[model samples]
Target: MSEMQDYRSSLSDPKSRKFETFSYLPEMTQDNIYKQVKYIVSRGWNPAIEHTEPEQAFNHYWYMWKLPMFGEADVDKILAEADACHKAHPNHHIRLVAYDNYKQSQGAAMVIYRGPIKV
Candidate 1:
C-alpha cells in the first residue's frame, strides 16, 4: 500500500486520532485538487464524482466532503456547511481544515492550536 493509505489505515481507530497532518499545496486550485484526487485514486479509493455545491469535492473513503479553500479565503462558510452536513451525515463525520498556501510571507509558516468542540 502507498504511504497515504498506510498512514490512514493506521488511523482506523477514531478514538486514537492524533494530530492530523498533511502537505497541502496553495489552496484547492484545480491543479491541487487534481493532485489530491490522484493520491486518492492511487490509494485505491474510488471517490464520488457526483459533487454537489458547497462540498466541491468529496470522498467516501475519507468521510469528508471538502469545501476547497481558495487564496485568501475565510473558512467560516465552509465550517458552517460542515456543521450542517455533519448533522445530516452523522455516520460520516466532517472536519474543516484550511491551507494558507502563499501566506508564508505572514511569518506564520505553520500553526497549531487546541480547542474543545462538541464533535
Candidate 2:
C-alpha cells in the first residue's frame, strides 16, 4: 500500500517560488477571488493591496497599492482596487492583505497574481 501511494518532489529551481498560502493551490478564478474578498469584508477586516517584483518578493517589503480600506463594506470596491493594482503592475506579483483592527495584526493575506517567472 505504501508503494501505491503517490509522491511528488518539491520544486528545486532557485527561481521557482511560492508566496502566501494561496499560492500552493490552483490559480483562482474571478469568482473565487471575489469570494475571498467578500469573506474578508464580511469579517470587517480592512483590505489592502501590495505588489513586488518577482526577485524582490522574498527580500524587500511589498509596495502598498494605496492606503488600506478602513471600514470598507463594499467587496466590489475592494476587488476593483486589487484589479487596478494588478493592471498597473502586470509584471509584478500582486497580493491582497486583510488587516484586523481588533487584533492589530494581519488577519489574512494571499498572492492574487504571480509575475512571470524569469528564467
Candidate 3:
C-alpha cells in the first residue's frame, strides 16, 4: 500500500485567506454549490445568506441579505437570492448558512463567493 501524505506538510499559507468549511477544497462549480444547497434543504435547515468585506470576514458581523428563509424548499430561490446579494455587493464575500432549528444552532455554512483580492 502507498504511504499516506502528512497533513502537516500540506498546510495552507498563513497569509492566504480562507472562508468557512469549503475553502480548504478546490473552488466549487455551480453544480457543486447547488448540490450543497440541496443537501441543506434536505436536512430541513433554514437557509440564509450573508455578506461582508473580505477584510472583516474573520471578526466582523456579516450583514444578512434578507431574513432567514424558513421553510423554503426551492433551491433555485436560494441561489437567486445569493446572486442578487452578489450583484448588490460585488466587493464583499458572500456565504450561505443553514440554521438548524431543532439544534438551535447553525447546521452548515460555506462561502459562495470570494471578493477580488485586494493588493
Candidate 4:
C-alpha cells in the first residue's frame, strides 16, 4: 500500500517525466484501443489515468484517461489492465488506453488509440 502511494506521490514531482494527457473519443472500444495501449506500453511509458464523467463514463458517449508515460518496463501490467477494461465493460465496448507499468510482450510494440470514446 505504501509503495503504491509512494509511486503516486512521485508522479507530482516536477523532475519526473510522468506527464499525463487524455483523448475524448465517443466511438472507441477494446478492438481499436488495443493498439494505442500497446503502443504506449511499448514506448516503455505508462500513460496517466482518469475516470471523469463517472456517470456517463464507458456507458453513454465518453471515455477519459491520463497518459503518464514514465518508462518502457511497465507494459505487461498495463496491457493486462487494458484487457481488463474490455472485459469489465464488454457491453459498453469501452477501450482502455494506458501507459503500462509492466512489459512481457514481443519486441514489436503497438500504438493506436481508438476505443468507445471515438471512431
Whose TM-score is greatest here? 3
TM-scores for every predicted model: 0.32, 0.86, 0.87, 0.31
For lDDT, candidate 2 versus 4, the one ahead is 2
Please report, in order, the local distance difference test score of every candidate based on alpha carbons: 0.34, 0.86, 0.89, 0.41
What is the overall TM-score of model 2 with all chains considered together?
Answer: 0.86
Query: Residue-wise lDDT of candidate 3 within 1-119, one digit each (tens)?
Result: 99975433212443367677688788999999999999999999999999998777887699999899999999999999999999999999999999999999999999998887664
Q: Which candidate order results from sorting by lDDT in descending order?
A: 3, 2, 4, 1
* Model 1: worst 10 consecutive residues (lDDT sum): 106-115
Evaluation by TM-score, superior candidate among 2 and 4: 2
Q: C-alpha displacement of 48 in model 3, angstroms?
A: 0.2
How many residue pairs clash in all the candidates, one count each? 0, 0, 0, 32
Runs of candidate 2 exceeding 4 Å displacement: 1-15
Better of 3 and 4 by TM-score: 3
Q: Give the better candidate number (3 or 4) by lDDT.
A: 3
Best by lDDT: 3
lDDT of 4 by residue, 1-119 (tens): 35533333232342222212323223335555555656755566545433332224333344443343356445556656545554554434233334334563333322222223321
Model 1 reaches what TM-score against the true structure?
A: 0.32
Error of 3 at 34 (Å): 0.2
Candidate 4: where is the Cα deviation over 4 Å?
1-26, 54-69, 72-76, 82-119
